[model samples]
Target: MDKIHLKGCRFYGYHGAFVEEQTLGQIFVIDCTLLVDLEKAAQSDDLVDTVHYGLVFETIKKQVEQHKYKLIERLAGAICQDIFQEFPAVQAITIKISKQNPPINGHYDAVGIELERQRP
Candidate 1:
C-alpha cells in the first residue's frame, strides 16, 4: 500500500494520568502513516485524487489540542478513528505518540505507544 508518512509532528496537549502532566501540559510528538492506494493520484496528479496531507495535519492538530485523554493509547485510538472516518481511502493506519521527558522513575527521555489499525 502507498502511504503518506508524517514524522515528528509535535503538539502541546494536556493529556496524562497525573494532575501536573494534565494541568501543565507537555509536548507530544506524533508519527502517522496513512495507508492508501495512490496510483490514481500518481498518474493523474490531481489534488482531488489524493488525500491532502495538510488537512490530515490539521485534523491531528485539532484532535490533539482540543481533547484531553488519560492515556496516549486512547489518544492514538481516537486519532486512528478520525483519520479512517475522514479518509475512507485509507486502508490502514499507524499512529505513534510520545510524551517528551516523562515523569517515570530513573532517567528517560520519553515514553510512548505505537498502534496500528486496519479497516474491515
Candidate 2:
C-alpha cells in the first residue's frame, strides 16, 4: 500500500514522571506514517480523494499540547487510535514519539516510543 508520511513534528508538552517535568513541560518530536491507497487521489488530483495531512498534524499537535501523559507510549497509542477513528481511509499507521534532550544524568540526545496499529 501507498503511504503519506509526516516526519519530525516538534511540540512542547507536559509528559514526564518528574514534578518539574510536568510543570515545565518538554519538547517532543513526532513522526507518523499513514498507509492508504493513493491511486484515486493520484488519478483525480483532488484534495478530497486523499487525507488532508495538515488537519491530521493539527489534530495531533493539539492533543499532544493539551493532554498531559506520563509516558510517550500512551501518547503514541492515543494518536494512532484517534487517526483510525477520525479517518476511515487510513488502513494502518506507525507513530514514533520522542522526548528531545530529556533530563537525565548520562549523555543522551532523546528517548522515545514507537507503535504501529491497523484499522479493523
The per-residue C-alpha lDDT of model 1 at residue 112 equals 98
For candidate 1, the 10 contiguous residues with the lowest summed lDDT are 100-109
TM-score of model 2 (CA atoms) = 0.96
lDDT of 1 by residue, 5-97 (tens): 989999999999998888999999999998999999999999989988888999899889999999989999998888988988989999999
Candidate 1 TM-score, C-alpha based: 0.96
RMSD of each: 0.9, 0.9
Of candidate 2, the 10-residue stretch with the lowest lDDT total is: 100-109
What is candidate 2's lDDT per residue for 1-120, written digit by digit as tens?
999999999999998888888899989999999999999999999999999999889879977999988778888888888898888999999999988767787877788888989897
lDDT of 1 at 99: 89
Model 1 steric clash pairs: none
- List TM-scores for all candidates, in order: 0.96, 0.96
